[model samples]
Target: MFKKFLAIFTLTFSLINVALADQANPQVVMKTNLGDIKLELYPEKAPITVKNFLDYVDNGFYEGTIFHRTIAGFMIQGGGFTQDLERKEVRDPIKNESANGLSNLQGTISMARTNFPDSATSQFFINAVNNYNLDARGRRPGYAVFGKVTDGLDLVVRISRSPTAPKGGHRNVPQQAVIIEKIERLGSESKAN
Candidate 1:
């Protein structure tokens, strides 16, 4: 009986550790029409931004969204507009977390916002080149860098190279819609992501 109890306790402890490990730096995969982009979020560095993104992912908010804007050598932006160029309603704006020390380097994903700081909602962008200019500059609140592409970065580059034109009053809109099929957390039962 003593040996059996010890074995059960060890198993439970191991499972608990696994759960905590997964939560430490949760992984997600953004399924875009161009291709799949695997991302690793830095919850420790940008907890609020990461939580906001995960909340959208959990709610399937990105389904069928289009990578509306793509600028060569700049970045590919998406997650807010649909393929039809209609803007989706999003949750309230999140606080700026760009001072978390993360840079806007190539392959890194950052929250997309307007000229007004602290207005990032559901839209996000992936840097195609090192975009250090977007990093926090002292008092200026820069775009928040919450995650980076762990795999399929080549897909991001491809999306950035897409042909673009002005559409629906938005500039640099992709002529060919680059749709986001879905975004899912990596370690669920469908760990395929």
Candidate 2:
């Protein structure tokens, strides 16, 4: 009788673990001139934002883009401009998912928007340092944080430390372009970290 109970407990525990693994967040890798950065997105917390980002990834929207904005000790922004500093027209703006309870901690990725709150389209930024002020506060809308860097965070920090200058009317543009070669979704088994 004791052996049977132990067997049942083991089977239940195995099933639970499988479910947990199956529910793991989807991951993507952005191959760049600087280096590859792997990120895991929390669709459960910000479904709309994640879907929008994944759609851009699947459509190859981020390929050949340049990191158009960078600030030391702040964040690196990209996914909207070509290597030539031309802005690519993006799809309709997405709803602000900032209230999703995710913080803008170091390495976390958030939507880059204008002052109007819900104006986020294709542009996104990775926090190079803890940005608690970017989190949603009460009634004010903040940037929607949908993911975080899982690997190559040091590359992000390095990119933040790059020198910047005004270009095409945009300030803090990296003097040497950091090109995004491509962004690809990783299969569940393909997650490197």
Error of 2 at 139 (Å): 0.4
> Per-residue lDDT of 1-193 in model 2, one digit per residue for the tens?
9999999999999999987864588889999998999998999999999999988988889999999999999999999999889999899999999999999999999999999998999999999999999999999989999999999999999999999999888999998999999999887534221
Per-residue lDDT tens digits of candidate 1, residues 141-176? 898999999998899998899888998999998888
Per-prediction TM-score to the true structure, in the order listed:
0.85, 0.88
Position 26, candidate 2: lDDT: 86
- Residue 118 miss distance in model 1 (angstroms): 0.9
- The regions of model 1 sitting more than 4 angstroms off are 1-23, 188-193
Enumerate residue pairs that collide in model 1: none
